[model samples]
Target chain A: MELPQKYSEQELVWLLKQRNEQAYSYLYDHYSGALFSIILSIVKEEELATDVLQEVFIKIWRQISLYDTTKGRLYTWMLNVARNTSIDAIRSKGVKNSRQNQELTENVYEQAGSAEMKTDAIGLRKLVHTLKDEWKILIELSYFEGYTQDEMAKMLNIPLGTVKTRLRSGLAALSKIIKP
Target chain B: MNTQEYIESGIIETYVLGMTDAIESAELEQYCREYPDIKLAVTAFEATLEQHALLNPINPPSTIKVQLFESLKDEFVHPVFMSAPTKQSAKVFDIKPFLKYIAAASIILLVISGAMNLYLYTKLSNSSAQYQAILVEKTSLQANNQLIQAKALDLFNSMQMMTDPNMLKVSMPGMPGKEKNYATIFWDTKSKDVYILPNKLPQPTLGKQYQLWAMVDGKAVDAGMIGDCAGLCKMKNIPSATMFAVTLEKKGGSSIPTITEMYLAGKVS
Candidate 1:
């Protein structure tokens, strides 16, 4: 669906605060695709990703007043919400058990590769493939997986400083690919 | 710590990725405000990351949006459903006769007020529509008044110029073929300004206009085109002129007057 040109980002936010349904619909139509992909990346299950997406949007609507423009762009704040909510869904007991059972039957890397393939043949997949495994893993963990530096350090059996450096190098490589 | 080194430390990247803890993120935010370069770096990093994230879009099922909006509609209509109330035993209290009378009276009052509200609302809407119509009429009248005021100001200025002692009024009687056509030139000799009050010139045919000329030293210099011949039109000024004339010319006035088309001519004394 074509996004409405009726309201700008600030105006849309103001309308959303006033609980305007059309503004909410516009926000959903414009941002839901990327937000859904982010959620799917972390949860790794379509059903759970859908549930988490619904919850994320509800949270966005409910807590919209808390969003401050000085902090960042609205999309960036929504991205954070999606990432955190997806992480929370994965960490929940029911989802954790299901994810662990699935992990036992399939190789994690293979699953990730398949999920990457499931995405449309956009340039992002090609760009992601160009990164070395270490950089890709760091990006996936911090960006898609919503892992903190300390958690990533423990998860990867690396030091906290190493985790930060790897994340920096990963983003630098990604940035170069994005622009160049 | 060197700010450049601090930037190169990957803290901004981590911040963009949302990997930094609360305290570390706060410190980075402070540093970004303190250093312009750091802030720029952070903004660039955030933009790059945001673009990268957006590029991998996967559209959600279309039905989800409909279902979501439907749920939202329910919440809007019955907000009490949002928070589930715990079940408790119902308490029973007997109604007193005086309280019953108060309730009955309040219901009757509510009906009366509701009727009054409906009546007032209809009256208000009717009055507001009439007010809007009046406002539109007022605007139209104001526009017409401005046009009349402008014309009056022009006429007043022309009268003042006509009565000036330094002004010389020359009457150009019609030439032989056009005996009924006449035009008047009000020349301010001191200021070297010329104006024409076209009294009897017929409307020019399509693709034609009346051009006024100042005849100086036997040469007819192009004065100006009288676009609409009915008004007091200001024509071109010449330092000194022996005669003034009017001739029919093409849509745009020519450099030299068409002498054969001359309708009126008068010599200056």
Candidate 2:
């Protein structure tokens, strides 16, 4: 059967629940790039992020039935799936290494090359770069790195309330900075 | 509750970021549905995050999509078999063994009557047949009672949803050419659940089904397909809408609504 090119969020959710193959392809084609970038930010390797993207899609396909629209938008839900899956991959990689290697794994970003990476949206990258260091760190750690608020507070040597406040303002600022 | 303070407190941002724990998330979502300001704040953050992702999309190798679809091919093989059974049928005790016992008893009676007399044998067999018929009737009545109970429970739930103060009832009258068709949507404001009751709407022709649309900000959002639901067919949950409509589409529904085939339309007040 011929499939429509674009689907509204609700229709996409419905068809995905039905396990429609066309819808699945539509979902991948439409959202994979965005999802890949999120995974790349967390995992920081195109090859690894590609693998994680596959896992994310598989998880989404298997668990589409459990998705509750009331919880959030479909992309938000999928983003969580992608983020969590990417985070899990990182944590497991750390666990697999020796204590020294684990520390090295954490610092891998400093040594990793950015030449091969292609984050096509130069404006978005520029906007994020323009944010204050603290705000950028807060967004990256929480959003990309999937760190919890309490963990961030301890790590940042700030009170839990401070972390909440900073995160709020940071996100609000980020939202405004990137607004088209 | 001061919605402005709550919004400014940053919980909505955290909630949109998927950082809020279950309880906090649930509370924020409740507030979102109840307070327009909170909802708008949540929506704004969600939109911002979506835009953020869209702006920084990194195309994965094209082969990944091909591999992904290949991995998912098994799911396509038996979608129907793997689907969860929708109807929970009431289990009735099997009556076949009872019929066998009755048949055996009649044969025994026949053997005994042949030795005693034929007249007594006919009377015994006739009474056994009557008893068997009564047994069948009783079981059928029990099954009918269970079915009625199930139906009653469904009616009760439908009524509760319909009578809920948070539920908005939108009566969609037929469009110009199909004026006789009508459907009512019972939408729960808090839960965002949508149920469409096709009252006078005609049955869709083969290979076609009626699809529900929630018009939000002048765009048609797919609510769900109206399949062969009897009393109150539950559609997808609609977060927000200004109007609702129904259009005939190919079976399984279309991604974009076929506006020309719209049969019913109604504004939400």
Which model scores highest in DockQ?
A: 2
Local lDDT at B212 for model 1: 90
Worst 10 residues of 1 chain A by lDDT: A117-126
> What TM-score does chain A reach in every model?
0.76, 0.81
Local distance difference test, candidate 1? 0.76
Best by lDDT: 2
Docking quality of model 2: it rates as acceptable
DockQ of the two-chain complex in candidate 2:
0.29
lDDT of 1 by residue, B1-269 (tens): 59888776667766765677899889988987888898888777667666766665788898899878877885443221223333345355554446878989877877897798789879977987787788677777877875775576467457667877788999999999899999899888888888899999898999999999888888989888896632578888778899999999999988888889999999898
Interface RMSD of 2: 5.3
Best by TM-score: 2
Error of 1 at B235 (Å): 43
TM-score of 1: 0.50
Off by over 4 Å in 2: A98-127, B79-269
